[model samples]
Target: MNQQRRRQMAENYLVIWVDGNINMANEHCQNTLTQLCGVVNEVNQCTTAEKCIETLQENSEKTSFVISSGALGQHLVPEIHGMPKLDGIYIFCGNKQRHQEWAKNWSKIKGVHTSIKYICEKLAVAIKQCDQDQVTVSIIDINEGDASENLNQLEPSFMHTQIFKEILLDMDHGRQAIKDLVKFCQEKYQGNRKELKFIQEFERTYQSTLVIWWYTRQCFTNKMLNRTL
Candidate 1:
């Protein structure tokens, strides 16, 4: 094959979702089909995300392109867990207005947020990257932080409640919790970047005492526990 032809037939994927192509990875929705590709037999035609995932695991292990088909597009993406084969993500928001109108408070969805952050912090290091100059790797960051950064104007914040003593109490409790957890991790697991990242992600994601306990355990390694805890 000619060089130009080979270049066109490269293994990299450029998945285009149908019906605005928001995100194909959302494991929720009742349709059962969580992925689509230009290929015919690659998609999971099952009735649920669980079944679809099982089918994919049984099928060809080739690089898959998961996209949407525009219909039933106003769906929220699920927090996909244990998807180790996915190489990257490409989101298409063709002239569609964004969704999500939840209150910007931690107390509302701290559990889910904590879970997501824990996954991202672990997977960020494992994410295989492509050189931009050689071939573009389409990565539509699924974080709210990314969306906010795209906006040009800044939203004003209103200072309402005063909780100085509460804040101090929370801090003191948090420090003690961290100390305890770090000591535990050091006693239990190997000291690695993954463990460290897990701790930081947990701390940032959740605010309550339960989250604090989990974060403290994840924060400690050998040297880390010795120095900090």
Candidate 2:
């Protein structure tokens, strides 16, 4: 996708990859980016700690995870560790033993890893936990006050979400609806080979009885549904 279109997308969370040695032209760097993008739609690369900090500040409203090279993270983590927008930090370095000593001191620092794949595994779990945390329900006691007044006081977004939920629950989705949904997903993930594979699997085997299974499978269905919410 084009940079402008990507920036406009309202993703719940993003990733910041900070490594002074990052070279996009290198096959390893490109592969690492591909893996990160497979997990999170937005991945910003910054070779300097300053650029990463600036990106975090500029997008302060969004939740973010950072993967920093151990050399930079040693100093960088102390500066950005307390930012409310920063959710988690992973120290990526060639020597995990060296970084683990200091990385263990910070609660926000999830782990120190030598392999990008291991980091991605930990990252997926972190992002899933973040998603669960974001899904919140507020309870209002109508018994203590006027029901109408209490309902009127509800946040607009909450009320709208409730209405949308009710409408979806009332709808009877037929075979055509499933087909259309699959087609829409295919179009949306046109060039993403990984997600496209998941879409195809969903199309081939999805069943109403397995809705919960599909929703929790850490694939395109789960990611897409969560983003829609």
lDDT of 1 by residue, 62-124 (tens): 333333221222231232223454343222233222321221121211112212233233222
Top-lDDT candidate index: 2
- The local distance difference test score of each candidate is 0.31, 0.81
After superposing candidate 2, which stretches have Cα over 4 Å from the reference?
1-7, 155-168, 174-180, 183-191, 206-210
lDDT of 2: 0.81
User: In model 1, what lDDT does residue 143 have?
Assistant: 60
> CA RMSD for every model?
21.6, 3.0
The candidate scoring highest on TM-score is 2
**Tens-digit lDDT track of model 2 for 107-166:** 999889988998999998888887777666676666555878776666664765785465
Q: Give the TM-score of candidate 2.
A: 0.82
